[model samples]
Target: MANALPLVALLVLAGSAALASATTFTVGDSQGWTTGVNYNSWASSKSFAVGDTLVFNYETKAHTVTEVTKSGYDTCSEANKLSDDDSGSTTVTLATPGTHYFICNIPGHCSSGMKFAITVSATRSGGTGTSAGAPRVPAMASVVVAAAAGAAFIKLALL
Candidate 1:
């Protein structure tokens, strides 16, 4: 019985840690923007963590989730790339644990509030943590709302 006590305690602790660390965030198109949600703009609760995947749902207008850094923080900007807008949606896996700056590269959209921020937390769990977040992901039954009609697709050269 004495040996079993210690083993049981270890198992309990491991389970608690897993419960606390597992999480996922489902990001979708913005509603306010006539151009639709340009970048990492979700419904609300603008925050996220590592091991989480940002699901960019499609709309009639094509948009991209372009990772970037602030004007003075150029280091992060170096490794950033633009995800192609196919299937009207896609998912970008958050690999590193840090503040990810993103914006819509669609013409003047970024300047028009088509930008947002996501914080990726670094919890020790097989590199990529489980997808978890508040306001949980939406059900599959709902249709994605696209940008207002006549919003032309803007093309820009990525950095």
Candidate 2:
């Protein structure tokens, strides 16, 4: 029974680390997904990870977010698009590690520099992931672990 306390602590720490791995990023920052701004520069300034999310905020009537292939992105082609969203607020999760491309499908939007490509890394440990804020689960887990440790200590004292 005494040996279980150390094992529990280890498990709690592992869980805390895993919960901190995911991150969310607001795409384009304050300017958001829109025209007249340099999307390329916005993308270049940030690092993306596989588990991170990209949130695109824009005016739905004036713009549409389209996920496209490399070829489609290059030619600003809307044909054979992978996905399209005009919700004004689109949340895209980077599920895999690869080069993902997005563009505004509104006529000349893509040609006018409304396109950006982000390369997501496979692992978050390469200093390529953005931390939106502190991981909530880690803090909660730490508190729970501390309580458990206290209980364990009390039980040992009683024994």
Winning model by TM-score: 2
Residues 1-159, candidate 1: write the lDDT tens digits. 334445545655565455444345555433432354444435234445555566665453565556666641233232445443434555677778877666556666667666667666676434332324332333322211111111212111211
Give all candidates' CA lDDT scores: 0.49, 0.81
Give the residue spans of candidate 1 off by over 4 A.
1-21, 28-47, 72-87, 124-159
Alpha-carbon RMSD to native, per candidate:
18.4, 4.4
| Poorest lDDT segment (10 consecutive residues) of candidate 2 | 128-137
Cα lDDT for residue 37, model 1?
48
Compute the lDDT of residue 91 as modeled in candidate 1. 66
